[model samples]
Target: MHSVQNTLYVMTPNAYAHLDNATVRIEVERETKLRVPLHHIGALVCFGNVLVSPALMHRLADEGKSLVLLDNSGRFKARLEGPVSGNILLRQAQHRAALDTEFALTAARAMVAGKLRNSRSVLQRGARESADPGEAETLTSAADALAASLRAVPGAADLDTLRGIEGEAARGYFAALNLVVKPQARQSFALDGRTRRPPRDRFNALISFLYSMLMNDCRSAAESVGLDPQLGFLHAVRPGRAALALDLQEEFRSVFADRLALTLINRGQINAKDFDEREGGAVMLNDQGRRQVVTAWQERKQEEITHPLSENKMPLGLLPFVQARIFARTLRGDMQGYLPYLAK
Candidate 1:
């Protein structure tokens, strides 16, 4: 399996991409800039006004590579992918399993439980490492509350009730997010309970960008296992929503994005100066800030971690794909139950 997590992000505006047989060529100002073999690319993310040739598109589709387009501000615009792989039988199984009441509830519980546990782990680590005793106490209390919610996940009777439990846990987790930031940067990087849509604060802006990147990874993972990204047990499906990807991403938010965001801020790799405030009080990352975060995120993905369920060590970038395969096995009746990744 060509499981390399090589995502080529074309950030330069007006960069041209084309296919030279099995090679992907990039041109800027009528001069060749970069060339990569097709097998090396898992996904291509184009930002701003980059142009992709038809030949390249054909090659990407044939090889099952995803092409995602994002605006300059790092918001998702669209994605292009080839025909769905895997047997229709697998998809049928997925569709049926999603609609089955018992199966749906089971899957939902696993996702919520995994998210709560991972979130609590993040808080516990912060509590242990934070210099401020008051902040440590706050984080510890929030972690205990999230732990309680994790225990309640299995007993929820319906999807709505399960959603309520998950929401409460998430709220509790974010409520303590401010305590995770160092006191030196607390005034600038303070999180006011997870605001979004415009991301009023600098902290929320960075978090939203990290989440977009994580969601893309989950989408690719779900597709690789022949599952429909739009259908999900934990999230309600609607037009233009990759519900399953969102559901899968919840388990990784704390361990992946949240930790990285905190590291960037506390270590001063990114600060208030990296953010730009618009007239409407919307905060966003400047281009330099975006590049810094992308570089850090790519490095973070390369770090090794042990899988709690499989007891196998792997790069953090490959976690989503591993979990997707596990979910597929459960849906196909090969596995007795689905186990969501819980960070240790």
Candidate 2:
């Protein structure tokens, strides 16, 4: 089992980070702000203008830790890491499996099935919890729609057909996701539909930020298990794109990122005041908002959950690594097929 470790996020503008002996120290205005042992961190993520020393970068890479940089809005900028590690034979098997159309289709189907099933679970929970009868009905209808989509997954003839089904289901799911927000906060956190690149609304901005962080974890999970993050069964291989990471993240999006976003919004932890409206109609979480979300995200990761397959409890943060290992097992023929994590 992969142990859950902290991902240090440095979002304070103009902060400088450097290696001091066996620890990483952060300084602002030439004064020490924080110092942490490097061994305790799995990854170091910097946002905006934070500077990292070359010695720290070298140490991180040597220790097999990742360094990720994102813009203030949580958009990915770059990632630095050590040389590729993991089983060469396992990666070769993964590459070959990607070329097998039947295998690819089967894996893609399972991924879509997991996504739809989890999405329906979210909607059904929302329906039961909603105070307003009309909102409850709307959520129930959407859950039913997602159920229908789940049924169609087995019938998908090819990857394109499966993708089409997933796309259609996602459209309906997002359309109904608005009801999940509390009634009083709905006016301020309205989400017409999913938007990205430059999230148009506050809700979109919040979720996009969470999704970026999730993506980084997924990518690291894939690499940790000796699977090529670039080669994927469900997503097409492309240069500079972590297709396999994206594939692994499908099962986690609604349950992890979406759920956390809703929790923060509905519970009044994050509100309209947390976001900043930029020129060109882009909305994003300001520094204070990012700190709040990051703290909540870290806390959420510490919560334990029972793995359906293993029947063992583990931290929620370790799910991606577990899933990635399962994927590697399927590629290596230890498992008949890839089994996705299903939320209860």
Poorest lDDT segment (10 consecutive residues) of candidate 1? 1-10
lDDT of 1 by residue, 242-268 (tens): 999998998999989999999999999
What residue runs in model 2 are displaced by over 4 Å at the alpha carbon? Answer: 1-4
Cα RMSD for candidates in order: 2.4, 2.2
Candidate 1 ranges beyond 4 A from true positions: 1-4
Give each model's whole-structure lDDT: 0.88, 0.91
lDDT of 2 by residue, 49-155 (tens): 99999999999999998999999988778999999888999998988998899999999999999999998999999999999998999999999999999999999
Can you list the residue pairs that collide in candidate 1? Answer: none
TM-score of each: 0.94, 0.97
| lDDT for position 201 in model 2 | 95
